[model samples]
Target: MKVKDKVVIVTGAGSGIGNAIAKHFAYHGAKVIVSDINLEKAKKVSEEIVTNFGESLPIKADVANYEEVKNLIQHAVTAYGQLDVLVNNAGVGPKQMAKTAEYTLEDWDDVIAVNQTGVFYGMQLALQQMTQQGFGNIVNIASLAGLKASLNNISYTASKFAVVGMTKSAALEYAKTGIRINAVCPGYTESALLDQLLATRPDMDARLKRIIPMQRYGEASEIAEAVVWLASDSTKFITGQTITLDGGTSL
Candidate 1:
């Protein structure tokens, strides 16, 4: 999975899984564009990559916004001359976990805006650029909730399921167009998001681990490695598939 010299754009790269993916790509010699709604965080990651002798640029963008997403794609193309890969990794979980009947419309809207609509914006904009260049790859960061019900988190599950469906639909449409689209579904990974969930319910950590056949949570780096491979030429024959990295949680 050689990504050397490839221009890759990873959204929501300020922290967590997005951060891991950005650094992983940089370490593999790809020119990574680290983007997030938080400019400072994005800059910090970009600087760290540069300090490590990797090429990167920090761009502040709210993926949920169409104009910002458009500008982000333009900036990357302007800097690298061509867009090679776009990791639609920007996502958000629900602020409060609730069952379907108890879920508020406000929470549902908020989660869908960032997790689902944001991904659509990135894929749509990236496809435009990739079509012109005749080749590109998109690796969307989904969740195991996308594959199965997450019990209390209705919005998060719905949004991720949308991502999975979107990935397959787009992949088929662009299959012969030289642009590949796929998704990685991680389960209970160690991330700031997971920390927040654990903080709310201190006992959830163990309960979550017990469900996984491997009896452990996944690591962000492990998810990142899979993402880089999917985005690389090594997965040329792979498209429209959602590779689950959830420690057999789905099993």
Candidate 2:
């Protein structure tokens, strides 16, 4: 897969999967915009990219805020001349696990704000720029919960499912205009998020591994590779598709 010279923006790139995607894209010669709510973390990732791979710019933007998202896109275009790809990867899980009926309104709203509405904001703004350019790509970071029910995680499941739906709808609407949209659904990936989860529920580690066919968590780099391929020219014919990287866990 080749992404040389492409200008790409990745949200939530301060850590975890988003961080890996930013570095991987830069490694492949893409000029990357590492956007995160935390300015310092984003700067650290951008500096590391510049040191080890290629060009990168760090920007602070909370994906949940429409205005911030708009500015993020504008800044990327101003710096790079054009936008080639946008990865809506910023997301948050419930702070406390609860069933649908027991789920708090606050948790639900918080998760939806950053996970669902945030994705829409990024997609909408990126679409405007890509429409003008007449060619672009988008890779949304969805989750296994999007494809199937995740016990005690209604908010996260709902948000990710929306991401999958939005990716498909937007891909179809823009397919004729040279913009391709797609999503990657990962299951139990090893990241800060998972670490937090495991910190509270130490027993979950064995339970989760027992259920997954591979008996191990997916790596952030593996998910990044899939996103890169989707954004690359090799998948020109593919659009509105959700590629699952769950080690057969869905099966």
Candidate 3:
């Protein structure tokens, strides 16, 4: 019951990991704010939550945009009266383009804007409100790429590394003031992007599975479980750190 009746904002909730986390939290009695860049998808997720007897606030926002993020937080506050948890989960990858040596500034900017800077803005605003309330939890969804040497997409790894650094530094500064920040570094999960990758490279699937100690790809729910644990009071003393759910791929 650590997160019972709490208010949480989960960005990118339209699909993939964000969607799973939003649903899981709602199932656990949290009033979840399902947010995403897709307005129609966000609305649908919100409706689904309600259908399952959970409270939800659907918000259309691009975390890459600062003004939109600001308004999103405002909407949560205006709706829920108090903010208890913030999951900075909105992100993108270079799966859109695989050419690193031939990568464009436009390509690098697009990924960094959403994956890195977007997390920064969300954390800043979430921290601002949590400080005033004197209690809150912040979970930034980072990636194992931050810990490894990513070859195809350098910008993605760089941004995720920045996210991990920001998580630790902010956790240190805010832990005393009642805000706890942490990150979950997920390896290859069964997300939309993964499906897309598998669709395009139907042959590389086996090689990819062999890289991880676990023979199977991680699920979005597995990552959601980690976020939920970190969001709850069970992890009260576990700030300024990262939990890698990568099936020992880092080992």
Candidate 2 runs further than 4 Å off:
none
Per model, state how many residue pairs clash. Answer: 0, 0, 0
Tens-place lDDT per residue, model 1, 1-251, is 69999999999999999999999999999999999999999999999999995899999999989999999999999999999999999988777887899998988999899999999999999999999999999999999999998878998998999999999999999999999999999999999889878987869888888898999889999999999999998989999999999998888
lDDT of 3 by residue, 98-156 (tens): 65778778769988999999999999998888888999999999999888887667788
> All models: lDDT?
0.94, 0.95, 0.90
Ranked by TM-score, top first: 2, 1, 3
| C-alpha TM-score for every candidate | 0.98, 0.98, 0.96
True lDDT of residue 79, candidate 1: 97
- Model 1 CA deviation exceeding 4 Å by range: none
lDDT, candidate 2, 1-251, per-residue tens: 78999999999999999999999999999999999999999999999999999899999999999999999999999998999999999999888888889999999999999999999999999999999999999999999999999888899999999999999999999999999999999999999878867876769899889989999999999999999999999889999999999988999
| lDDT measured at residue 134 in model 3 versus the true structure, 0 to 100 | 96
Backbone steric clashes in candidate 2, count: 0
